[model samples]
Target: MDNYRFILSGGGTGGHIYPAIAIANELKERFPDAEILFVGAKDRMEMEKVPQAGYKIEGLWISGVQRKLTPKNLMFPLKVISSLVRSASILNKFKPHAVIGTGGFASGPLLKVASVKGIPCLIQEQNSYAGITNKLLADKVKKICVAYEGMDKFFPKDKIVKTGNPVRSDLISLSENRDNAMQFFNLDMDKPTLLVLGGSLGARRINELIEDKLSFFKTFGLQLIWQCGKLYYEEYKKYDSEEVKVYPFINRMDFAYTATDMIISRSGAGAVSELSIVGKPVIFIPSPNVAEDHQTKNAKALVAENAAVMIAERDLDTEFEEDFTDLMLTKNRQQELSDNIKRMSLPDATKRIVDEIEKMLGKG
Candidate 1:
């Protein structure tokens, strides 16, 4: 393992980006002198976020195909060709022992190059249903680290390893931070707190739902800590008051988890993974706009385990109040959901993923 070098690529969203960073961070802890390089799409968040994590990253000239036919779709082949050439050039220069793809536009090219070069390559899929990029690269990669079971439907069963998503290291042990969390959000410790996450950019429906229900939430004597997301901050900021804390995005997510008695969230892979660790009684409102509507599938996996409750996007308008009221009134239901979700958590996800990487490289 001396002087081990690795290439990891993923981005476009925090769900993909943070896992790649967590894997890179874990690698550094194991081999302090190890050289880790990140490859990400040019102009994507990873270009900025990866560098902020203290890792060197190169940007690929790449983007995903639009679901609808567009003039931009005409440029897809050229971007793919340009990215593949650049990825090969990168692998040739870095000469890494292995490569990891956490599923993003850039990872497709980067891992394709690494797999063709006969280098050990692994991919981490964060959802219950596989993403388009990972599905295309499935056979080429050596191992697939996953957070959900029954991924055999998407990936080769022999290559699959059910390792959960790596949560932010700072988010662990939130129970111990309860007092600090209360002060952090400046919320009343006596009232039950409801934390709503709409993701970094925001979800239109979730924001609209909250906009319409702020009074309903207030009537229940429920204190709210709402991450309205950057896009909707201006529209929703007026709702912020002594009982409701509003922010464009949350910096202290650990505190948010600790302070909340209930969670209303969009069920992305990262959110589900983190909440499974937080062990809160969450009511998942899965976004319907994603590829394969996988957020709903991600939530369903937990619902089957009795780890959380779920409502489809179409059902939210008609069903949210009744569902929410039932959850709030049932004290044992909260503890039951919390305990079950915690049981499904994999605290050692990063460690387990890296263990597979080591095994792949024959350094296990």
Candidate 2:
């Protein structure tokens, strides 16, 4: 183990990409001299993001199979075989000590090749409802790190480690910055602040819903910090004013979390995990566009625990105002959601996943 080398694979979306980057970061911190390489789908976000995170990455020609039969489905087999061949080539050359996957088309082939090569591998499953890639590789990997309970339904119980998803470390510690946060956002602390996140690219339904309720929000006496996302900033920038501060993206997310009293967001696994750490009463608007309606399922997990509220994208027109009104006025309900979500947070998840990796290498 003198020259520890590791390969991480995942992509397609931020959900799959960030966790791999987070784990790679932690491994770099612990083993400063170790070589960490990333493998991601060629055209996906990870090729850019991984490099931004200061790691070299190799791309595989890969994409997920479409749900409905279409022309793209014909390319599926060729893509998989090509990806498998490419992944095998990379594995042979890198000769990685361990390969880690965070669930995407690229990871499927990369981890499968590594496993066949007798390399120990691990996967971090972000959602309560496991993704197809992770499920397929469950038995092949040495360990399965998950963000939710009962993932035994997907992976072997003996192999599953209940480590929550890794989030930006800066987000985990900001409790002492409230006063500075308020000033930074130029927000008045007298009004109850609502933070709205539509994710980095922005959710179309959430943006439209916010547009429909702008006047009503002011009537409800709430100030807002809205992240309309980079994709829809121009469409929603008109809403920005004294009471509603709108941005394409909030780079200073820790400050945004600190300044706000409550959150209205899309309940992707990453958002759910970060919100749990922020310990705010959150109203989730899960995107219906995702595969298997997983966002709604992710939100339902917290709703079951009384840790969050949810309004389906289709139900937003009918349920948004009423549910938000009741939650906003009910002080005790707010506290209950906040406290319970905090209990669900796993701030040490990155460290825990790295611990499991070390154990696999007989270094634990």
Candidate 3:
């Protein structure tokens, strides 16, 4: 793998950014001498996060085409044109061995340019349902790495590899940190813990449900570790009490997972992958806002195997509290969910993806 440089693109949310970072981290470990550069949409989280992760990143003036006719939609064509030109310049200057996309609008132009240049291109789709960007680039990508099975419905069957999402290494062997984690969160270890996560920016529906039912947590004698996301934190901060530990974000998620007896979460691809590996009993509230309702599809995949329980966002008002209360009280159900979810985990996904890349590079 001589003359190897890497260009990684994808970022609009942590789901995209974290997976790209995970792959970049894996590549760095395998190819320490390889120059890695990140390309992401300007003014997005990746611009800040990529640098924070100790990598060089360049931003392209790109934004998604709005589904509704809006002022932003008018600028879509110009932005796409500018982004493609800029991506070509970056690719030309860096001469990367491979261009990897992790599924976001910014990746569309960048990966399209790399494919045109005949650079080996790979994409990691972190959803059960394919995003428009990944689907559009599917024919051009040399290989497609995915977390869900039956993705041949979206991409070419021969090009697809069912590599589960790469979780943070710290999470893989997370063991025996229950007390430390509870102390860190200032939670009570004597009480059964319920950890609720609704993605990095937070889920408004989930937040609202928690807000309305904050007192219901006491019913099960449960300690709460609730990440209310930045948007809802201010409103939810008032609910923080001795039994409830509330935060805008949890930096050490592995600790939170280790400390908890159960999890309440949105079944995003990354969250599902991590939860499966962590093997915690989960109550999934699939976000309806995502493309193709992929979050619901993801949740169903596990629910079908009796690995998780799904509560629709719309049903949360009437159903969530009751379902959650019953779930928390049922120890047998929790153990069953934990065991079944763990059975579906693919912890070696990072290694498998790297192996595929190396095989494509003919140096494995």
Which candidate has the highest TM-score of all? 2
Q: Positional deviation of 188 in candidate 1, in angstroms? A: 1.4
Q: What would the TM-scores of all predictions be?
A: 0.97, 0.98, 0.96
TM-score of 3: 0.96
- Which whole-number lDDT from 0 to 100 does residue 127 have in model 1? 95
lDDT of candidate 1 at residue 274, scale 0 to 100:
92
Predict model 3's lDDT versus the native: 0.90
The list of candidate 1 runs beyond 4 A from truth reads: none
Clashing pairs in 3: none
* lDDT by residue (tens digit), candidate 3, 68-168: 99999999899999999999999999998888999898999999999998998999999988999999999998999998888999999999999999888
Location of the lowest summed lDDT over 10 successive residues in candidate 3: 211-220
**Reference-based TM-score, model 2:** 0.98
Output the lDDT of residue 211, model 3. Answer: 76
lDDT for each residue of candidate 1 in 1-364, tens digit (9 for 90 to 100): 4599999999998899999999999999988989999999999999999999999999999999998999889999999999999999999999999999999899999999899999999999999999999999999999999999899999899999988999999866665567898998888888999999989988888888888898888778999999999998998898889999989999988888888999999999999999999998999999988889989999999999999999998998899999999999999999999999999999899999999998997877
Encode model 2's per-residue lDDT on 83-124: one tens digit a residue. Answer: 999999998898899999998889999999899889999999
Cα-based lDDT for every prediction:
0.93, 0.92, 0.90
